[model samples]
Target: MTYKGIAISHTILFLIVAAFSVEPWYFLMLSVAQILFVPLVLKLVLKDDHLIYYFVIPAVIAVSILQITEDSRIDSLLALIYLLFTFIVAMVGFKRFINRGFTNIEEFAIDMGMMYLFIGGLWFVASVLEIDTGFTPILTWLTGIHFHYSSFLLPVFIGFLGRVYKPASYPWLTAIILISPLVVAIGITFSTLLEFISVLLYMIGIYGFIVLAIKVTYKNGYQKSLIVTSFGALGVTILFSLLYATGNAFGIFGVTIDFMLKFHGFFNCLIFAFVGIVGWSIWTPPARYKKLQFPISKITGKGTVGEKILDDYHINKTYMGLVDDMSIFVDKESLPPMISNFYEQTMHYRLFSTVHWHAWFKPFAALYRLFSSRLQQLNLPFTSREMEMTGDIVAIEDGRTNTRAWIRKIETSTIFIALYSIHTRDEKTFMNISLPLPWSSMVGILALQEQDGKLLLTSKSALASDAGIYLAFRGTIFKLPLEEQFLLEEENKILTAKHEMRIFSIPFLTINYRILLK
Candidate 1:
């Protein structure tokens, strides 16, 4: 039988088993979530259509075993098996992330959904084992349910929506949703203040999701109705939750646990989980990510070292510029003369730059400076000296990438040996730069933009664009959790540039450069 067929059959068999078991109504309710809802949502979100579907069956059997058995040893063992399956699912998501990098938010949401399943599994195991989670037994079980539906399914549904429609506020709302699960967990465990704040943010994110849902174009009216009802159900549940949180925190308005289970939980499981699953299953969106087709640098080690290194190696030809033609990226008629000349005839210029490390990162930068020269990679100094940067551009024997190695130096020490190339995605050209390391490489894919007589280049980009800083190792490329921007302008008749790097939207480093014609 096909994996999906087998999974459905297994779920049916468990539903029959749960029907006969002497479990409480609440446990039976969880049974439907664990057995039926999880597999359907897993298959929908994953879109794998393979062995991943088979993995769902074992976890289903585990949950079914939990229903009929009272032996703690057996229950714990079964729950642990279920947790193992969730770990495997999380790894699959991590692999997808590595293959695609951080190019699209929808894919990121899907990956996180897959990863969040592990937390649900952990909580399930904790509940089955009766482990102390700083909450009542019933509440602990409810937390497991929260992670399964709210944390896992909610983001996966949002991700599917993002595949078709993302308004301007999508990323910010997505960020809020992505982090809310953990935030809520922390707040409940420690501080009432944090709990109150997280609920409000989570509510905003959900409302924003509902607003975007209204804008999406679905395949059919049935699908649209199901999706709308799904999010709309969530909107009601979230309101109840906000009231509950406020009651617990500030004695404002009280919402009892029993009231939530009847209304909030009932709506979420029946409408949000069930209806949303059926809605997306009717017409699954195509994955927003594809395998990255760009070439990677083959060069390894500390790069060419010592004087006469170029003389010792067979030279193909020296390059006079980073790119052969500025017109490939921009129209020559539109570009400033200095900007055009700097790209096409870069060898005819002299560069002086002053690097500024942000206050928070100075200590780390100082530590890196101690060993950076030995690596001969990005061996930038800690000082803010406007030192001259000298580099020779040599043609690299990379195949279709047509890469050139720019061996740059400051004073006597090597600073950078960047292998520069270019690639096109969605009809836009990107500057591809790779720095070789031991059996690995750090790559930067920068998109180009021209605005008001200046050139802006950045690793941050729109959806489906290959523009990010990535680390490639063992034939796998994954995006670094950081962003970089370079702005070039002819300020007051001299070619000037500002380079900035940010991690989590916070700037940590900046460098200003002045280029002069020789």
Candidate 2:
């Protein structure tokens, strides 16, 4: 008999059994009939291997036995029977009905079987735990017919349609159908107009599928199989719609039918219908056998190896590695000349420089005596001619340098009467310079020196004071692939001479650095 006949007979039998009075003997007899009839029917109608028949017969018997037994202690046994029945039916349908070769059939069967078993097992666990209301009425209906939800019957329906119909011939139509349910579900959950559009799209998808199915049927002679399937689909769709409408119109158990009802229940039926139709088209190619076309290049953009590396490094975190490789240098000869000029020019502007030599006390004393004699002849104040300072360089790098200095100025200074000068990195030029205490307090400067090519830079500032306390700082920066070197001349070099002082304090520090290059 055709699938439609089988479905009708099963439904009628179930209804008859459900309506009649509960009798153990009657159920036993009915169960026996179910166990015997399914194999007989399969043997007569299906042109598959006898192995399927062998497995299916035992599975049906097991399901029947489980259904006939009412002891709660046998619940695990019942669950096992149900799982077995589901597995065997899935195997038979995929292997025999799908006709995608035995390999594909076996794979699909195993995949679907595992999915059904997992779902069923979860439900069984929930039942045992008393976490959920055990098996719904639909599930019980399948059990009554010695079948389970994972039975071969649904797959057969799907496979039969695949063999007969081509519903996914239009890719956009298939996509719309698939996306509609998801959109509707979102809309219902959020209660938005967008969701309503999803519902509309879902309905459109259903209409499209129906139209496609009808067209295929008409074009290929209204074959009995297609006619029966079309009727079954129509019936199922209408039943689902009605159930959803009724549930929404009147709340179940006085609980309002919310987003789930409107989107999931009302719209999902159409979505499932679209899925079935799409599966059909994919499984059974069109008569013309047109190749499936796709733009692989468009999906994946063009990129060479170097381009990819550059893009990845720039776009991601790799640039930090590049920054870590930089180094800095200070042109020592140029620094003293720059400082001498700055002191002379800014002397009229109330700025002065001081140098501290803590390690070379004797040399510093001798130099200080010579400077003092020269200054006395010029009639400058004793403080102006003398300087004392000490500090350590904190951080030095290619782009920037930093230093801290502690300085003490004599009370007899001819310059502004400040006891100390604050040392800081000059912001304007890449250099370290000292300013009087009051001048340093009024302005702050951070000096940075960057060299592209052939550029000698000396930046002095009244602005470096705000950066922090620094006694003295000096550094230079140059790129890789150095070309030439210059010697340090004694006449060109100007050194600062100052008083010697005992080391009073020192602080320990930890430094971390990294280098990167492309």
Candidate 3:
């Protein structure tokens, strides 16, 4: 008999035993069924006398273990014995069938049956174990299908889908396996017969899409763009699902069954599918076109205010330098618009000027004043002319909006500069400047200067108010540096600096610079 035939025979016997539920009678019957398969498998292996003992001795030991073990462990022992017997029988049968070079549907069916029996037997044994199955909690969380046996149903269903569709490539097979958990989770989360039916339909659709994708890929030699686009889409969908789940967990979004039933649970899948199709079209041109060229104009665009802000500070340059050394980094483009808007606002107001003043104003003015007794220490360069007048410089009259007024005060500027030096192959100066501003008031500056280096770029209104100063500063200092770095360049007689500002609700300033060769 073929391996598939042996597998089906074993499955039928196991189901009959399971119907009896690990009783002594069921154990006896299982032993008898396994013994019947052992001799048949041994006879098949005996044709090769050189390996006859190697195969037969193990089978004998397994049979002995099943019959002699009378404890509660006997159920597990019996399951193992059954698996071993079925595997050996199937292996021998498969070898004999392959030698005969069979290519008919019957042989294929037999092979599938054998695989099912092997997997089913192993699953049954695992279910009987008292130790925690790591996946049980996840499965319980997903489907409410608490029965240990039900866990095996998902893999079996997936197997059946694969068998029925007969996918043309490994990627399609992989996708089906990968998406199975998501399908199960959706079904459980929705918790209704209709939702279960919807999951079934979705599986069918996914299987069809995979089959079509595989066909297209085979016809076009595995399009790289399509693969990348598909994976990208899948990634986005997973992220959306995670977000939605988080929202539900926190009682913010209120978990809804309709999301799964009507919209495939998450928005990412549809987005990915659309992208995959578009990417496939781009990667594989029609017959009318001899060659395809991606339009550079379509891929690139004019700089935005946020990009401009990043460019001004040499943020991008710093990023590129650090990216080689660091594993984690942030993308300036991904910053929220509100935050970027605030940064741009801060730049326009020259917050970095205040920062420079905070660092250098007091010490330099004190030293200069000390040398020239005629000079007053308080009359430092760029000190606000209206220092004595301190209240409500800006106000709002609209009744609908909060009637908050900007308050101002002048305090002695203490210059604090700490420097460290390390020997390196090239002489480079790295400077970081920060200033703490009044928590309740907006801060602005008069002017900013870089002594030896050209002002390659200047920030345009970057604002960080009291609410979130730490996050704002860390983000601005760490992320904006890279973009600013890329925008600095020298042309003709003038050195140019470019910067981008991202606004946030906090108090902070960051200035990036690079000196040009004279």
Candidate 4:
């Protein structure tokens, strides 16, 4: 119903980020986790895990073997495994780009983050596997850190900043933020002059982000100190990145590992990771505790150009392969009722409400709520607010070849589905996606026919993998996907689905909801 899903392992990425920075024996293991497991954890968040999960299954055993075995040969073998997985996620990001599946800006930036992770992954394999690359072994190790911090984390945080600031309106600045991370990573590998240019670009991107942070805070009634502290750390964070990039290019500045570990490492691991994981977590609005009610009042003035531009985005996502399956099991007259219920029931829990956290976080959460309460008063510009939420499910009809559906709405409710077939490479393949609209996501169901012909439905194709969430914040930017299901019985009633509230496939809460046209 919404892009909002719970991830039990939402903290997995942050934990990996924090754990590896301090450098433990498992640091080598966690570094790989950042890429392989981060995506897996994200799958729990997005609730869309595919074959990629199966590919990384061996990592659990390999990591365990790694703890007991310190042989370089074994390490190389494990790196090889992780290297293959990294390539897979990188390819996922690439294919998404080619298809233009990053429907919005922050989603687009996160895809780029995947590629940078591959860059870091490459260095990680080289250092751990001890491949005979031209660079010194230590440099390979440092390069791994460089890609993780500068190339990987930089873009990811920038993507978050984009959500907070909405950088897409500023075309030139968005272009710089998007392009510099990759160019700098490539430049580091080949040429000094190129790396220098790339670092300058990278610095400029950071500056742009800082400027936006200040503006968003001041205009939006956000707690100024929190934004300042986070971006201020980011400012110094990128400076260390610049120094490292400079030293690598010129081979002159004595930027020792120890020196970097002390200042660069301390600030980035603490400030960058902490602020990103915690600061932004606090900054973003939580899901609404109650349905967001749009009052019927005198119409406001003409909508802005930005609003119209966003409303016109072309989205062509379909699961046509399942048409036959739907035809075989679904009752034709049930569609309108099912759709109506989906439309109304889901709206009750629509976006900007809550981030369910554990009881212990109350004191800290109270402080955050104090800030959030104030910020809500300010009508600061948010990209999500720009897009139109009004939608229509025009018709759901019985057709010769398949059931016809013409629908358009925001996110999962995108009732504006045009006449297009979402072609997949295989019959059962799942698309790697993260929708940009609030309370929106791709919906697919696995339908099975009972002996009596009653249909049973499940959200995922299989229980491919599972994640353990050590943290569940009530209103954290709801991401994780849930293990949910739906059913159809009577023609006029539409569909019967256990609208399960979940994080990381674990149903924390649920409701028996019915969608009906009447």
Candidate number with greatest TM-score: 1
Question: Could you tell me the C-alpha RMSD of candidate 2 in Å?
Answer: 27.7
Which candidate, 1 or 3, has the higher lDDT? 1
The lDDT for every candidate, in the order shown, is 0.82, 0.33, 0.32, 0.46
Please provide, for model 4 over 1-518, each residue's C-alpha lDDT reduced to its tens digit, 9 standing for 90 to 100: 21122223424433444453434532543444453335433343224555666655565445445444546456778877766766776787665444433133565665676676677778877777778778887767777766666555555555655655564444355568778766865786788779888878867867777777677643244444565666677688677667766787787676666666567655665566545544444444321122211111111112221122223332343232223223333453444433333423432222221123334544554565444323221111122132333333222221212222333333433222322122222233221211112222222223332223334444442321111111112222222345544443435444444433344444543334343333
Q: Mind giving the per-residue lDDT tens digits that candidate 1 earns over 159-237? A: 9999998787888899999999999999998988899899999999999999999889999998999999999998988
TM-score of 3: 0.22
The lDDT, on a scale of 0 to 1, for candidate 3 is: 0.32
* Candidate 1: stretches off by over 4 Å: 1-11, 302-316, 360-364, 400-402, 424-429, 491-493
* TM-score, one value per model: 0.91, 0.32, 0.22, 0.45
What clash count does candidate 4 reach? Answer: 38
User: Residue 493, candidate 4: how far off, in angstroms?
Assistant: 62
Report per-prediction Cα RMSD to one decimal.
2.9, 27.7, 23.0, 21.7
Cα lDDT, model 1, residue 408: 86
Report the Cα lDDT for residue 106, model 2. Answer: 22
Better of 1 and 2 by TM-score: 1
lDDT order of candidates, top first: 1, 4, 2, 3
Q: Give the TM-score comparing model 4 with the true structure, all chains together.
A: 0.45
**lDDT by residue for model 2 (401-442), tens:** 222121222333222111111222232232223322211211
